[model samples]
Structures are given as structure tokens and as C-alpha cells.
Target chain A: MRKPPYPTVLKPYGQALLDLAKEREEIVCLSGDLTRQCEIDLFRDALPERFINVGMAEANMMGIAGAMARQGLIPFVHTFGVFATRRPFDQIVNAIAYPSLPVRIVGFMPGVSSPGGPSHQAIEDVAIMRALPNMTVIDVADAVEIRKVVPQIVDLPGPVYLRLKRGEIPVIFDDDHEFFLDRAQVLESGEDVAVIANGMMLSSALLAAEALRGAGISVAVVNAPVVKPFDTRTVEAVARGVRAVVTAENHTIVGGLGTAVAETLAEAGLGRPLRRVGLKDTFAEGAKTAPHLFKKYGLSTQDIIDAAWNALGRTDSAPTAAPTPAETGEYAPV
Target chain B: MPSSTTTSEVSISRFADTIRLRAVMMVAPQGFGYLGQALSSAEIFAGLYTHAYRPGHDRLVCSPGHYIIGAYAAGVEIGLLPEEALLTYGQDDSDLEAIGTETSPAVDLTCGSLSQGLSGGVGLSLADRIKGEAGRRVFVLASDGELEEGQTWEAAMFAAHQGLGALTVLLDANDSQVDGPVSEITTVEPIAGKWEAFGWHAVDVDGHDPEQLVRALDETGSDPRPSIIIARTSTRQGLACLPEDADGHFIKLPPDLAEAAVQELESRLA
Candidate 1:
């Protein structure tokens, strides 16, 4: 059993941002004592004057960023995804969102990616950030998308809540692949199943599609990185002729990719059999590795394959033996 | 627009009295507004706008946004806002809200929530330092009750750590809050000592006295830390005619009593 290549996206993100900071003095960095953990140390080391370590106070970091924005300086804040969305929600709404400041809040360890358990996992970040009026919610699918999106986010006018992949992550997209805001990337197209996914789950979706092809079940993998201001147009188009639909994410099914896709389909009157693969209503327990958490939370490639079969109403026998982990009584719908 | 009245202490005192009268007129008709908090803050607004601050350039953040009625009254007194706009206090499509928010250009920083404005003031002052924008100071006026919010302490520490000498804070210690006396609400006493321990240049002053407030705003020692003035005040300081039992935190002034209070303020100005 060999592991796939997992390249660190944080290093390249830091390198790309450091280059941007050299050209733009208004680009200031803020962190809540996770400078090294989130790989903002690259900006800190290269340009100490522009980097601000606001200790562990996430709310104050948001306030400081809002104030900096008020004074015509663009501030980028980094922290864990949970703290980024939950800890400073009121401040982010009042100071950042209501005023529509250009503060880039980069939240790493989105959803079940953090093995630090429920406290560190941000399964509801996308749901909460999308609820904010002026907030642009972006979930990066891979290392290549992260590199391309950083500059695009800098050019964006209002506040953004960016879901990030820290440490080593697999490269799923090509180096020259195009990136657009409020747009979903159509990775592979098929007629049998429209498999929409975002964040780290997109890679798993691609794997599941590849594996399903061998079983004569074609699955369309649509990488939906931008959750808020969701690409419903592209989603409907991709899902138009597909026999069934499935959505995948590392976040909870409540307000993540699954809900967005369901809403799009429901509104379009395209009532196809739909299945969602992600964390249930239950909190994740601490695990040693992402693969372990993925298995426990029912986000592995096998879960996606099972969901695809279930969506197609083929429950007699499947590629994998175990039932859709969602049906095993581990998680209740939220 | 420059104030038509003289900038002397006596003139500012009379102007502050007129502002208090205007605040009562704006809020009293609404049947419910922050009349007491607004009256208590009139002198502080007068002291800053007339003596300590340059409104067009220097920034003033109202952390305790209920006090905005008083700020708007002072703006009208100083000819910053048209006098006829006073009737539009809580009406729809008006700049004025029942609670001050991001609706108006009068407030440099919009904060209806407590304890958040100081952080904005810190950012504005820090920006001035980083951008080399000299002669620009940021003043934040907050309630003593807002000190209970953790973000206030965080902003306090950051201001001291960054050496934000250009930032000044007026902690309106009106003792009263919506939940009753702040002492009973959360025990935010020993407020000046806390600021001093946080490495700020702190001072205690009679909040109602314009002389003391102006002096605190103007004086800064060799210390490069920020400044906080603990202003001990009564929530209903200007309306001596009102009963002591009348709750000032948020009140609907009786029509007759509201008129009588305004008459007393008008007589003092006369």
C-alpha cells in the first residue's frame, strides 16, 4: 500500500503572497499567533514591517484588520477555519462585512482536514460565511488553485473568507489551468452522474470517478471551489443530462456543497435522485491522519462510489461491500 | 463649518447645554431613546469638537453608539448638520437611527455594539503612524460598561504594545447601564488602574466638566503609550428638573418633563 504524493500548498501560497507584498505596500498581513502554523512566516520573514502578529485574539485581529482597511490599507488575516468564522463572527459582520472592507481572512484546516478533532475542524464555515452579505466564500480544491486564487483574492474588492489546505496537499489541477471567481471548474464530464465536490474532497471525487469508470459507471467531477455566490449556472448545465447527481465535501452536509447543489437543483425543477457524501451531524473525534478522519467521517473515495450507486437506485450490489457509511447509523441528518 | 459661537469655556458650556436641549427634543418625541446617555456626553463632545479635535481630519469613534444622539446634537450646534434635520431622528430614510450605526457620514467609525470602536480607533491611529500622516489623532468615546467586552482589553493591549501615542480614549463612567448600575452589571470598577497596568497613560476626571476633559485630552507625558480618561459622570446630568427615579439608561421622557428639561437648558443658554 503506497500513499499518493502530497505537496505542501502553504509554502507556495506564502511565496506567491510575498511577491505580491513587495509590489503593494497596502498589502499587510495579520495573524492570531499562527504565523508559522499557517505558513504566514514567509511574509513575516521577507517583510517584517508589513506583518502583524496580533497574539491569540481572533476578534481583535479582525478589528485591527477592519481598522487598517478603514485607513486605506489592505490587511490579510490568517487563522484556523473554525476560529476565523466562529470566534470573530460578530466583529466580522459588524466591522468587516457591514462596512464591506477588503480584509482577506485566510482560514486553514477547513472541515475534517484537521486531526485536532471537533474543536479545530470547521465543518460549518462555508455555511456561516455564505450567510454574511458581503463575504465571498472561496474553497480551494488543490495546490495549483491556491496559487492562482491568492492574487485573484487580492484584486477582489470586498471581504473574503478563504478555506485553505495547509501543510502537504495533493496537486489535482494543471499548472496552467484557468481560475475564475464565482465559477466552478468542470474537471470531467459524463452523463450518468454529476459528482460535484469542493476543497480536499474534490481530489477524492476525481479518484472515485476514475474508479467508477472501470465499473462502467461514468461520473462527472465538477470542482466547485467557490461555494457562496455558487456557480449554479454551470452546476445546472453539468447536471442537466446526468442520470443522477451527487455532491461531496469535507464539511457537514447541512450548508456545504450538498445544500448548495440541492438548492440549485430544487430551484431548477431538476428533481433527479441526489446523494450527499460528507460529515454527518455528529462531531469528529481526534484522529492521527487525514485519511483516518476521512474514513471515520465517511468522506473516502469508497463513500462517493457508494453514493453514486445509491443515487442511480442500484442498491442490490456495489463496487464496495459496506453500505453508504451515512446509512450505518454513525451520523444523523442535521 | 466653523461654530458661530465663541470657543471659550463659558461659550462651550452654553453650547453644550443647547446641544443637550436639542438631544432631548430629538429623542423625547420618539417616546423612547438614549436621552440620559446623550445628555451626559454633551460636554465631552463639546470639549473635543471645540477645543481638542479637528473634525474634518481627526477621527472620533463612538464605541457606545447610543451616545450618538448627543453627537448629532453637537454637530448641529457647531453647524455641521442642518438644524431642520433634527426632526428626522428616528424616521425612515433618515441618517439618524434609534441606535447609531453605519447609516450616517457624521460618525467616522460606526459601532452600535459596545467595546468595538476602540479597536477601530487603534487601527486608524496605527495607520497614521505607518503612513506618516502627522498631526492626525484618533479619539474614541466609549461607555464604562463597554470595558467588560474582551475585545476592548485586546485593543488596549495592542495600542500600548504598538506605542500608539496619537490615540485617546474617553471612558464615560456614567455608573448606569441598561441592566442597572454597571457596578452590578459586571464590576468594571478600578477602570483607570486597569488601563495604567496595561501600559496606558490613564487619568481620572469629572466627566461633566469641560475644563478637566480638555486638559486630559491636551496633556501627554514622555510616555509613548496611548491615553484613557476615566470620566465619572451622571447619566442625566443636564436635566436637573427630572426626577432622580427616572431611569436614564433608555427612557421615554414624559412629554411635560421633556419640555421642562428643554426649558431649563434654554434658560441656561439665555
Candidate 2:
């Protein structure tokens, strides 16, 4: 299959973050020995004084970030999503969250962005960060989105967690596309079904919408980057008009976009039959291959098509079958 | 809002006495608490809160938050917090929460988890430094037990590498932790060496000696390196009548034994 046309005018999020660092001297960057891995090398090269490498210690990096925040510097702590969530959760809660410190936690290689096996894949980062109070969670859909969102996060009052995709991120939005921390963008509008997606799954959802349209099933694709203060109004509005909701994400189905959409629908009394197309309540196991795992966990375009059809009540004619637990049971919940 | 006070008269012996008296008072209300750790850390807390630290409405992040009573007593004595609040220690509906409160004016960072305060302190200190505010120091009191947390070392390494001269870490090496002695659980020996290796200017001192602590703090004044004061102290430093084997982390004194401990403290104070 031919890849979708890449956004030519898109700028990398890492470059945007480095630009912010130049403008704001107080905006310090900290990494846990994953500078290149997390794409913080630009910040390191440009603002050497402001960049700190804590050397593979995520917990300590978190604590130091909190301490730096306390001292009046805006510290942007970087690490893999898994390490940031699991290693220093206590530090994040107590030092950063409880104190309401202006510590920007940048989790690199989120979801299946890393090919370094399950250990590096941050499949459940959203679930862990979302549970904490006074936390702002943002999932950047592409480099353009991340570049645009980096400056806005600086002005935010409390703790901010930015989940970034490593390597070259595909652009899903144009420069003219309007974005807000609390608003979800309607990329493609339709009435038959609504697909709420974020991160890597967003592009897939858009592709699925196009495929569904070719099959005469109209679908609305909403890009929900900010997951904490989720665009509940947009969600409710979208849910009100749709026959069924298909929430997709690169994270686990439990706490990521799927659960967020499910809860929003359930709360608004707009409970439609919902299908969450993401990693099941499980971790990414087996070899460190992305394509194999993406196909296995039903996160690819085919999975979204099947899920969209299932939500549209056309499961009998859906092109793909629902993945049984036995076929993909090796990926247990982390 | 500033009061003129001097550390000249407050010697190590006097500070140790105050710690013992305060620990006794804390146990007077609750028959059993972390008296061993509190008493052991008395001289160090007294030195920092009274002399070395420039206390104001500014922050002090206490990680190893179990030693809260010791901090409270020091705050009370130094007029940073209300003395009456100490009476309500561990009571319901008290502003002086058994655990620290973020909303409370006295408490800076609400700490219960060990090895988390340095991060908060770093945040506060970084903010102050960026604003070009001088003389404001972020003091973090960490327990020996908290050394087990990799984050502490992370903060240590960051602070030193960043040359956060305004940040001072006081590691209370009272030799006791929950469950058993620290050595039995995780040997954090050569702690000063570890800090030195992390690029910090580490200094070891007799924790019961306030004079030594003050001198150590003075020496680190405006130094480019992140300063760490490793205070070697005993869990049971000042009080008698408490059993020698009593775990300072959590003291369990029967009613009669509690009364006797209080009486012993009272006699010492008298």
C-alpha cells in the first residue's frame, strides 16, 4: 500500500521546543540520558547551560525538575513515557503535582513509537498521568501540533505532561488549523459515525474515515490531542449526532482516549454502543517490531476499519474479524 | 516582618536540649510516635531552621516527611509557625496536619513519600534563580532511608551539575528506618563519598552538634557546587526512660512508660 503524502511544510516538534528554549532562558530542559532518543539534542546544543542530563535516572530527573521549578525556573523534564510514568510517579505526584510546580514533563517515544520492545513502548502513560490531580496531559498528533503546542504549555499554570512521538512525526494538521488546549478539532465531518482519536491513531482514523466513505459509510474524525480536560463539549456534541462512537489511540484501551470517550458518553447520557480500537488491557510484548505488534493489537488502519464498521452495526460485512484473546494474549496488561 | 535573631548563643548543647524537649512534648500528646528519628534529628533541624536557613514565607520542601514533628517543633521555636499548632499534632481537623498540608502556610511542600522533596525544592529554587532573587535558599531535609530512592541521587547529580549553589540538602543519617536499621535494609554508607562523586560538595558532621552544622552551612555559602550536609546522628540521642531497643521510626510506649518518659524529659528540662 502507498503511504499517505507527508506534510511538506511541517516542522519538527524538537525544533520548536529548542526555539522556545532560546526565547525563554528560564525554560530549562532535563533528560534521563535519552537526549537523542527523546529528540532533546537540539535543546542541549543550543541551550547547554539550561539543559541537564541526569544520566538514566528518571526518578531523580523528576525530583530535580521539581526542585528547579521551585527555584523559579521552568524545567522541561524528558524521558521515555514508560520511565516517566513508572519510575518517578511519586515524585510527579508529590513534588510536581501536589506543589502545582510549573514542571513540563515531556515523555518521548510514547505508545509504539519505540521499536525497543515492550520496555520502551509507553502504551499506558495516559492512564497513569490522567489519574493524577492537577495534571495537564497533551498528546501531540504530529510535529506541527507539537511545535504549536510547546509555547502554550509554558504559559500554563500547573504541571504539564507532553507525550511526544519520536523520529519524524507525520503532520495531520495544516498551519491554518485552529488548536486549543481544551478544544478538539473536527478534521472530517460526517453524521453516520464519529471517530475520536489521538496520537498515531489519529491519522489512521482519518484514513479509516476515507475508506469508510468509499464504502458509503460517512464518518466524522475528531483529533483530540489534549486528553485531560478533554474536549468534553465537542465530544458530547459529536456523540449526540453519531450512531455509534469508535475511539482509537496508540495507548491501552482502558485509560487512554477510549476510556475518556466512553466515560464522557456515559456521563452525558449519550451512551451509544462504543468500540475502543487500541491495545487491549495489555503491554506490548514479543519482539521489538512495531508493524507486527501494531497488526497484532489491532491498531492499524484495517483494525480501525473493522471497528468503525462494528460501531456502524455492519459487523457482519466488516472486512476484518475481531482479534481473539488467544491470538494476541501474550501482551498482558502492564 | 523580619525579626533580629542571632545564632551566636545557640550552641550545639542547647540545640540538642531543645530537640529532646520537643520530642518529649510530641510524645506527651501521642504516647508513641517517631521519637527516635525526631530526637536524633533535633540538633540538625535546630541549626538549619534557626541559624543557617533564611526562613520567611518562602518554601522548605521536606521529603522523608515522616520526620515532620521535628520540623514542626523547629518551626514553632523559630516563629515560622504558631507554637499552639504543635499542641494539635496528629489531631483531627488541625491545621498542623499529622502529614504535611499544601494549603497550610507553614508547610511548603506536602511530603510523605521519601526522596521527593529535593525535586520540589529544585523547582522552587529554579524559579527563584530565574527571577534573579538572591538570598532565598531551598533547603531539603532527606532521611537516610530515602537514599534508597534513585530519585535522590538523580536530584543530587542534577543539582551539582547545574551548580545550584542556592540549594542545600541535609541528609539526616539517624541509622534507623522503618522495618529495621538502614544498614540491614540498604547500606547507604559512604554517603558523603557518593555525594562528592555526584559533583556535590559533601560535608559530614556530628548531627547532634548545632555549632558544627552551622559551620558547615556557613562554609557552603555561595559556593558553586550543590551543598550536601551528611549529619551522622543516633536515633535515640537525648531522651532517657525510652527503651534502648525502641525503634525511633515508631516508638510504642505503654501508658506508664509514656508517663515515665515524659517525667524523665521534664526532669531534664528542669
Tell me, by lDDT, which candidate is best. 1
lDDT per residue, candidate 2, A1-334, as tens digits?
1125443222276688898888887788888888887778888888776777777877767776776776567888888888888777877887788878889998887776567888888888898899888899999776668778998899788999889876656655666666789899887788888999888777777777777888888788899999997889999998888898899889989887899999999999996889999888887777556766777777887888888888777746765322313123122111
Q: Write the per-residue lDDT of candidate 1 for residues B1-270, one digit (tens) a residue.
A: 333443576766876787788888897786668888877777788887888777789998988888888778888866778888889998898888867778754568868877889888988887776677877778899988888899999999988998888888988898888878889878887898899999999999998877777678788422367998888888778788978876879876878888888789888877
Q: lDDT tens string, model 2, B1-270? A: 243344553554565566667766766677777777678888877777667666664566677766777778777776767777777777888776655666443446647777777766665666666566777777788888888977677667767766788888888998888788899988798999898888988899988766678778788766778788999998877766768898868887667876776677677657
TM-score of every model versus the real structure: 0.94, 0.88
The DockQ for candidate 2, computed on C-alphas, is 0.53
lDDT of each: 0.82, 0.77
Instruction: List clash counts for every candidate, in order.
Output: 0, 28
> Candidate 1: deviation at residue A129, Å?
0.7
lDDT tens readout by residue for model 1, A103-199: 9999998888878988999989898888899889989876678888888889677999999877765565668888888789788889899899988
